[model samples]
Target: MKTLLETLGFLALVQGAMGLLHEFTDWHVGLVQRVGLLDGHEVYASVALIVLAIALFAAAERCEAD
Candidate 1:
């Protein structure tokens, strides 16, 4: 379970980085513009990634404690 959590956390971090890049470059603008939801997608993904990373770090600490 700990390993799984770590993996998920890593994935989330990577995804968040990508999302940020997209936002910076307006890479996803075309898609979001079509759907009319581009204004806040990056912020949401970034927050989610940060939460996932924190959760994984906490899980890792717990595993080490055990």
Candidate 2:
């Protein structure tokens, strides 16, 4: 459980950072854009990613505490 939470937290943080970078910068050459996952709505996708990252990190912290 702890490992799972930790992994999720890390993945969410990395993806969130990537999303933000792709949204504001000219770095639109990645798997996310390739598959049209966050194609048109980069802002929304970035926001969702940031929220997910925060939640995942919180969950990981809680799991570690327990």
Local distance difference test values of all predictions, in order = 0.68, 0.70
Each model's TM-score, in the order given?
A: 0.65, 0.72
Q: Residues 1-66, candidate 1, lDDT per residue (tens digit)? A: 788878888877776666666677867632223434555565675666767888897897798789
Which regions in candidate 2 have their CA more than 4 angstroms from the true location?
none
Residues forming the 10-long window of minimal summed lDDT in candidate 1? 29-38
Give the TM-score (vs. native) of candidate 1. Answer: 0.65
Q: How much is the lDDT of residue 18 in candidate 2?
A: 76
After TM-score superposition, what is the CA distance of residue 23 in candidate 2 from its true location, in Å?
2.1
